[model samples]
Target chain A: MTASVTSLVNQPYKYGFVTDIESDTIPAGLSEDVIRLISAKKNEPDFMLEFRLKAYRQWLKMDEPTWAEVGYAKIDYQKIVYYSAPKQQKKLNSLDEVDPTLLETFEKLGIPLSEQKRLSNVAVDAIFDSVSVATTFREQLFEVGVIFCSISEAMREYPELIQKYLGSVVPVGDNFFAALNAAVFTDGSFVYIPKGVACPMELSTYFRINNGDSGQFERTLIVAEEGSSVSYLEGCTAPMFDTNQLHAAVVELVALDHADIKYSTVQNWYAGDANGKGGIYNFVTKRGLCQGVNSKISWTQVETGSAITWKYPSCVLVGDNSVGEFYSVALTNNMQQADTGTKMVHVGKNTRSTIISKGISAGKSENSYRGLVKIGPKADGARNYSQCDSMLIGDTAGANTFPYIQVQNNTARVEHEASTSKIGEDQLFFFRQRGISAEDAISMMISGFCKDVFSQLPMEFAVEADRLLALKLEGSVG
Target chain B: MISENSPIILSVNNLTANVNGTQILKGMNLEIKAGEIHAIMGPNGSGKSTFSKVLAGHPAYDVTGGEVQFLGQNLLELEPEDRARSGVFLAFQYPLEIPGVSNLDFLRVAYNSRQKHQGLEELDAFDFDELVQQKLDIVKMDAAFLNRSVNEGFSGGEKKRNEILQMALLEPKLGILDETDSGLDIDALKIVADGVNQLSNPDNATLMITHYQRLLNYVVPDYVHVMANGRIIRSGTKDLALELEARGYDWVLDEAAAGVA
Candidate 1:
């Protein structure tokens, strides 16, 4: 229910145009029957099938996490459909050989799988609902000794790689969502850049939720060999629904000696209607690994959507001389609740990390920044600096910051700072006196609040993020 | 005809206001007319800024008593924005900064608010820019200043000059400059005073509130009033400013205390 441009305040659902899609969706329920059906339908190997069953058994024995700041009853696994796929799509030989309807669907989602300039060097894995749409550039990547394709395809073609790294960082029993994802992950990207060979262009995986009522469960894994570097971008969205949609995905990244990886996420899920109904629940587990000396990883995200968001893209520095950095801006409006941040664990000597999070809340929404930095006993010379700022626009909105630090090593240095302030009425009056309306003034004020993080985005994305924030935050203030 | 005895185009009778249950101004009253320049000099905590705050109808300040009649209408009844819309301007002592809101955008809103109040057609962005550029000349501010956030990161002098520029754009009937010259150097003081002088006309009145008489040497008030402890203790002509400057406020303090005795 997108509002007309003339009146941005009153419109309803953000991504409401349901595709005239025909999907093969199984009945709701998560049990041995559903797990076997998913594996049988995908024609998985014996070990893959066993992995799913083991994960399902582990999930049943585990209880739901009770520690998150979010408030919601335990989700009923019996009420969720584990798999759904585009009805007409079939396996194809080339990009052009893929279904035109499938390609058109992604194009409408603002993703281009075959753009001449960008597609030449990059690989594309388009996950439409619970199935991979068309993963192009895989043949070229394979020639260069790289592994780039859907996780399902990777499980079929390069099972050894998947067996080695899958569920290593976030195990099958890491958390409730992670366990569920491990049991029945429908589709996600799998990337492995070979030794000493940097991926020539950014590798991206686009996840589109087209089948209604079915929660999207995807799993992503990335590994970089020694002396190699790769930058990955993950983008996700969903069709609108009257009832809330659920998305619980798990992502893990592993880097070897002297390897580096930068993961950037631009999440634009449908944030439900302004009244806070029918948007997607974006819950994800993303983490990186520094397995060898001098490895580095950075996470940058601009979160502007989601009715309820619970995600923390984090990093674990297990290598000496490793580094991690996180920069994020989360905006919530009109019943949108976002409890997102990062966690950095320093287990190596001479490790450093920095986190800068900015949260803006408006229209009775709640935006919180929850982050942690823990240094281990041998993490001597470890350093961390975290600054979280919260800006509340209207009286009814809320903003909070919770930063947890555990420094066991006296040689480790850590610092955290937080401040919360409401947009002053005098500031609004001052702008109004100059000719800016209440809405435009609010936009200006928020832009200023987010300027620091906005400047950190890539050039094209920085401009896009700025304009998108302005559009989403329209009428965000009185 | 503009009444000379009614030298003030505006008059306030026993205005009282409070903020969050704490009274700041008690029965404040003053009068000003066209062609007259009045100086309202007062010691600290004497309801100087409170008078300006009340006139502008700051929501934080609640007027609990009396009334203010501006251009022959009840002023206290108007909202702060409406007060500004109806030719009443307050040059705040401490101008607030709104980061990321450009000076130009803020000025356009002020211009349109006044226009909309009178049911007049508002100007487009280009036309509004042209209108503001003309008034910026009165303050002698730089063209580049329009791109910066309102009062954000501006020097003390720039903030005051921006306030004066706003006054010129609104062209109010009764202008209240609250401690306008507090932080200005000699050169900045001359420039600010010169700007106020250029915008003054016989059809409008200016009430300058300050702690010192130094601003008078530039704008040259026709009448001066000494206020202390919430009331005006003495009134005199321009020479009174010089007398007060030579012999500080304690002389008026002795006379006021004796009168009370």
Candidate 2:
């Protein structure tokens, strides 16, 4: 019985096929000239070039941080390709200008990019390798004073907005990965919701990594002006290879007075084979800033892939009466390692935040939740509530929790709760005695355990997240 | 209520079982006919609980040498779930609590599993809700329990009532109550016994394992058997229970030993 359960989760990776096409890939290495070449390739403005140079100089002096609980082989910075993009003839004016093969690739991944097959309510910005291929509903969104386009296009069209808010929330020398991403991030999504305008449709971005040895560094920035609101989501996937790939991306969000921003992510990158031979190393930095009074920002993520994951999506409350929330569900199986959670920092009076995290580990994997909740001295009556739960499938797996809380104000209130559970034989037997198959039993229990986090997702994506978790944990327990 | 020509619901022959390499059920033999209620009384460590577990095909118990026939079919060949769907239900003495799974959902799933096995149409959430509400009256359970996690934070009597509630929903052919009377107060015991008595009919059989004779006062049994050393040594009508309750099991054990000598 145990052997059969172990074999259940050993299913092969589905999105492991590479697309064959002509790609303009740079040589493997990183330096000041590489950053300059990348900036020149994108035709960036002088100020943007200066920003990249400053970040590159700072990155040269910083060392890779070893504070996370994940272990891996040393990453040789000089042996990675900093830039890779599909070769195009000229600048794209619309979706018709996209390559047919590239559109076919996205279609096979269940993300239709063409006008005839695109989703009705969602406007997607499809990013392939290191460039944005196409963005849907651009004309409709433009008519309402909403600017939704590739970051490169925004840098050219709305340069003032980019120059003002770029690197404001996360500066050039914030951390190792953020600095590296600031230096050479090729393309990502850029959204600007004008004052008092609730964007007409849902905005999304789909990222696909195709090159074998090239690193993927994308940047996304969403700014909701006063009395405006926007909900955005992102998805990621990569092909399988013998050697591990590096993915270091940065996402920053800013919400002004009476504004709201909700950001969600469904990351399904290719985890290595059963022997842990090949996969992606995902290290990302994402943060949100409630910059004006009564602003709100919420982060929800469902992470199920990557051989080693190190990420912490955080929120900084800088305005009185602002609110921040983080809801996440992370699953790891078959020798995978993850150290992921959230951080909530209260700097304004009467600020509020909530964090709920669920981690599941199976097959000899190691999963950890490391979170922090800090309250400033002047923030009177600030409140925070955090709960972290971990579930183990087999006896060989490991689960850990490290929660750090710091409160300086005398009136601040902070509460933390955590628990660990395993899928024991008795639970399965009880279900079996009730005529339920083991497969159905395990899936039902898992879906129940993740109910709280799934409820925070958007309507359509909530169903997808539930199904994805069930598929990932099939036959993984007795 | 038993007729001489009635069908046999279960027949166990020379049943020998072991748990973790230690033999528990040694050469146990028994036969239960339709419409019959049989009670087995035994001292501790006499393999009473192991008998119910073995019949339910628990993974912990290994049937070394045994032949179990249910409705003239080889019962040992089926899996635990198949045994359940084919009309064998064991109400656990200590029901396991499953967190986050509501009682209504669990009952509906189990009912649908049996329905699917019998080649019948399964009930959706709306219809299953109506059906389960009617079944709740048998055990006198409140409607609020339908939304709570299955047996999680439930009182001891509430858990036992839930077991009987499942038995009502599944409607099995042979019902085995494994010391269901251990942790119930007198009021709860009467309610549970009334539930068992109401579920009894001309087509189903009941096997109750207990340590006290108080349960028999509510749901009277036709026969009472005393089990010792992993096997039944003496059997008689309901009068045997009255005698055993008056004078403990030592006299019976001595008589069985003298007969063996």
Best by lDDT: 2
Candidate 1 docks at the CAPRI level of: acceptable
DockQ of each candidate relative to the true complex: 0.29, 0.69
Local error of candidate 1 at B24, Å? 13
Candidate 2's DockQ is 0.69
* Model 1 chain A worst lDDT window (10 residues): A1-10
C-alpha lDDT (0 to 100) for residue A370 of candidate 2:
92
TM-score of each: 0.77, 0.95
Question: A339-417 in candidate 1: lDDT tens per residue?
Answer: 9999999999999999989898777688889898999999999999998988776566788788889989999999887
Q: Which lDDT value does model 1 have at A221?
A: 95
Off by over 4 Å in 2: A475-478, B21-23, B225-261
Cα RMSD for predicted model 2 = 2.3
Task: Encode model 1's per-residue lDDT on B20-82: one tens digit a residue.
Answer: 897777677778888778898877888788778778766567888887888888987765667
For A1-478, candidate 2 gives per-residue lDDT tens digits of: 3664576556667789999999999998988899999999998999999999999899999999898889899999889898999998777777977999999999998899998999999999999989999999999999998889999999988899999998998898899999999999999999999999999988999999999898899999999999999999999999999889999999999999989999999999988887787889999999999998999999999999999999999999999989999999999999899999998999999999999999989888899999999999988989999999998886778899989999999999999988776675667778888888777777877888889989988888999999888888774433
Best-matching candidate per TM-score: 2
